[model samples]
Target: MSAIQILDLSNNSLSGKIPTCMGSFSNLHVLDLQKNKLYGTIPGKFAKGSPLRTLNFNENELEGPIPRCLVNCTMLQVLDVGNNKVNDSFPCWLETLPELQVLVLHSNQFYSSVWVCSKTKHCFPKLKVFDLSNNRFGGPLPAWYFENLNAMKDVSEAGTELQYMGEGFHQDSITVTMKGFEFELVRIITAFTAIDFSNNYFYGEIPKVIGELDSLLYLNLSFNKVSSCIPSSLGNLSVLESLDLSSNKLVGKIPWQLTNLDFLGVLNLSENQLMGPIPRAPHFDTFGNTSYLGNLGLCRFPLSKECRSDETLQPPSKLEDDAKSSIGFGWKVVLIGYGCGMVFGLIMGYLVFSTGKPQWLIRIVEGEHRKKGRRPNKKRGGRRG
Candidate 1:
């Protein structure tokens, strides 16, 4: 293998194909057969004058069509073949690799309406990191395809906001025209560039000019079928980090100005059906509860629940009349201590049965009832003596 430069047959148990005589190893730069079980078609003579920069056939079971003669290896950089089963499209012949940068074709089957470049004024020109995540690539995301990548500003640095085109706004080539769409200006400078057209089937509503792409970071359009709301101009991206709109069908609220995306980190608005309240701040108070799981009309403060009356944490009415005047003063102090313990136990049972029994136990029960009431009071007082 001409003193192999770097040929790590990754996770080997290597199966057929891939050995077009290892392209006569003209100093193979790097070729790692990732998670192998490799099948066919990837050796168009290792892209002609092979000095392959870095190529990893990820999780393979490789199918056809990705070897457009490896774009003649114009000093090919990194091209990762993600979880493969590679079907074709969008490989626009590796955008004519001019020292091609990192480009990972995610979970393949690439059908496409976009991603075309063959130097139409400048495409992939020294492209910086570009990922086609979870492919099945649909429409609407092609504002001049990375705005004529003039060597993508020598590997990223300008304005930013290329990551899958969430909210828009990039200035440079001067092609404004919002709403009806039409923006360019070299995608405004060009440092940021992550594009993941999430779990297929992309639908409408999510284009509030992607907040003019002020250099976005990561943005994922969660399991698709996208509906309305959530476009509070994405709080103008300001270098956004990660924002995933979970399983869609999206409804209202939750736009408390996206807490100004202060370099947000991984915020997934879970399963979506979105309602009101939730949306405190400090980026949703540091998000937890699995980023608002299955949003059942979302309540406030970390979803412990309690915010219905048309939500937004409804409370005022003088704070619900001061919580019903402190629950009516705790039921008027428990009904004045149970009506003063039932009038002090009915005045101690009316002075113990009207003060009749206790005169030293009534003189020992009147001497045992004067011997049984003294024979009925001494035969009626001894027949009146």
Candidate 2:
């Protein structure tokens, strides 16, 4: 297979270790072994200068530290190893890859302190899509992690006065097309990336700077120990499509400002200690019962139920009047009895009219009929005599 340019063994029953000799494919550009039963550590030398741009080994039982030799493959564009048993400190070596575009490391056993690139350092400079969700990484999110390429307007704006990497330093801009719509890629200047530190032991209020990333499309931080009022800054993500903050210790009413996010498609705030009427908005109207299922205090549209107004909660002026108007078991019984009596009376009247007739009425009608009959029976009797 040394002459093979692309080899795809994905979605097969292939088992055991990947052959170390397969790395001899010098012309290979894409190697896919996803959704297989392959087990054992990824061969370190498999990624060195093999022109491998896309390598996917997802949904396997591969374990141990990610092969550090992968860092040498500067031409690597997409690296997906999600849904595996790989355990390692954060792959800081990924920061050095200049052409790496998409990086997926979700659903693994990664545990580390906060990832912080110093203010002057360039980490994953060409990265367009990065997902590190469902891991055990903890600590406060570093500010310099997502350097906004768009924010660097000029040499002076970048604040290189502190430390210059030298002139002619330009960050390449990448364009991403998702859902058949083209979106100009903008780096995460603030904190809102598609980062999911959910289902872990993280705590503290969501940072206010998270809202500054206008390009963010997906954000999930549910199933954590986070508390405090949701920052109103979240409403600033105009491009945001999905936001999930469920099963947390968050408190207070949802910000009315969040209703302004017109493009938002999915919003989940369930199983939290939130209270107040659900905010009315076009986006809110689109959501169904699943969106707010676990929040007991949330009442209003989409839930198809409204909480009582202050005036409605007050007692009526007269208890007797209120009791009469209110529907109860006694009212139901009276209505049923009245209906039964009317039906029973109609049945009895019909039976009596059919079974009984007045003699005076019948005699008057028969007398008139006899006068018209004449004396026809007399002549017949004389002949018989």
Candidate 3:
């Protein structure tokens, strides 16, 4: 079909190699062949100037490196080739796709550092969602990796109207691990920005620049070798709902500023080097012990291990007592003021009335009689005869 614009044959039992002549479909804009028994490497027949926009070849027996010719499909927006045996390194060239938005390379043989760009100049400018979990990607977590996600760095994008991903008939889907659970998002939204690098060999500190992504809704970097203090800058994520940094070497006090995340509903910081008292009250009290487990240094609230008097510096219970004391002190001041005012009123009244006032009372009565005497008698109505 030369005029075929959308070709979707996913979730099927079909087996065999992909057609090498798919490039012949000059008008094809969407191609999906995921969740099948297909084998062999992807054909590098994507002709130059092809109008392809969405390409999906995930959940298959496909092997070998991704077709480098995909770069020719400059109009491509979504590329998902996860859950296959595709042995390859991170596609540093994909950064050139001006229209690319979503990239999923999870559960694959993709390895090595994804630090393609040294500067944040022109990499994944419009990308909203990225998933590289369960891969062989390793090395230090570079701060530039997050500094370049310009789409997520803006807080205003969250206010934009949400739009579903994918084109007509064929919907895009990605399986993401969030808050320690794998969730497959079938109908993704444009405002739904996430980063999943879990189950990797990444080490070193999670970049502080990561906290600059204020528009990010979900962030997962669990099961890695990340260490050092969890940056307090993460409190700036006003829209973040799910945050997973568990199973790392992170240490130091849980940043109290994290309690500023009013929208955070799912938090997993278990199995880290965290210490000191957990932040108290309001947002933090809601989380279960699963969030602070394995970190013996993390004490108080939800955890049965009580910290020393110095360790639990400002526990929630103490904060409550302070609030109550302040209220009581304010009430005491108000009562004292009221008593003083009442005594003053009594004294004023005593001074005004206790004075010899018999003359004043008589003058007031005389004035009323004088005014009455000055009035003319009123004639009865209807008495004219």
Candidate 4:
């Protein structure tokens, strides 16, 4: 019926192309057919006055470029078509949607660098989550692209009120890449910011402008051809939680400035061309050997290879650790025995002196000497006979 707005047949065995007639539901807003056996491109027959707000075609066999007609729906907010066969270039035009919040084109054949639409102001200014990982995007990360991520720059309180990806008629859920896997987030809040551009052929220095995004919580640029020293400016991200730049050609020392990130929990700079001593701060120390593996040129605390100057290294080692344990046990035994003997001697001496040389107490003290004193007399008598 034209009156029906919400349609959700996702995760079913439905097959064949999405019915073009379904687009005639001018009142229809949310369409969710993800994780089904659906094939063919999205229908391009939506009405110009389309009220579609949320469109998710994730985890299907849908291929080809996204339907350009869907852009007619000016009210589009969330577009997630990840893990499909869609082979197309960057959809910079999607930035025109004023209310678009979440865009996921991960694990597809999307290629080329991202560009700004107007070049005068930010695009996707309200975008909270952007994932383009596992694609064919190449070239140095565009400077303007990072500059226009205005949403990533805006800091928000972590304990904000409850929220969801979309507020309109939708399936009420979407999948996002968290850490290194596809995770379905049932609810999303304002402070849940992340960027994952891993598994691409992107090369060149990571833009120092990335540090300007103070609200970024998770960032993964692993499995790329990125090179050059890590920008010391990244230390400015005081609240960032996870950072993965592993399996790249990145070189130079892990900046000591990174120690300033007190809230950093997960870090993987491993399998890189990095050298020199790793930063010696507490936060850097928490990460283990795996975080710095494959860097045979590296030296310092956590790694097995000691630095040229071991003064800066203070990693908890096994040999010295065993010595400390042995000394601790030996000293404890001595103290207990000495304490018991001192208490007994003091009590006996106090009883004899305080009781005016009490014979019983004095005899206990003199008993040893009395026996030796009598033994000498018996020896002299036997010698005289």
Alpha carbon lDDT of each predicted model: 0.68, 0.68, 0.85, 0.81
Q: For candidate 3, write residues 1-385 as lDDT tens digits.
A: 9999999898899999998887668999989888899998887888889999889898998899988889899999889998999999898889888888899999998888888545547888888889899999999988876787898876665557776777455677766776656677888776788898999999988788988898999888999998888988898888999999999999999987789899999999999989998898688799999999999888889899888888867634447879999999999999999999999988867866778556776788899999988855455433542
User: Candidate 4 at residue 98, lDDT?
Assistant: 74
lDDT of 2 by residue, 213-305 (tens): 666666777777788888888888776777888888888877876876888887888888887777766666787777787878777777766
Clash number for each model: 14, 0, 0, 0
What TM-score do all the candidates reach, one by one? 0.31, 0.63, 0.79, 0.76
Q: State, as a TM-score between 0 and 1, how close model 1 is to the true structure.
A: 0.31
**Candidate 4 lDDT tens digits, 295-324:** 877887788887786446544334677999
Superposed Cα deviation of residue 86, candidate 1 (Å): 2.6
lDDT of 2 at 100: 72
RMSD of 3: 9.5
lDDT of 4 at 81: 91
Which candidate comes out best when scored by lDDT?
3
**Candidate 4 — which residues are off by over 4 angstroms?**
116-120, 157-159, 167-172, 310-385
C-alpha positional error of residue 96 in candidate 2 after TM-score superposition, expressed in Å:
2.1
Q: Which 10-residue window of candidate 1 scores lowest in summed lDDT?
A: 170-179
Residue pairs clashing in model 4 are none
lDDT of 3 at 46: 88
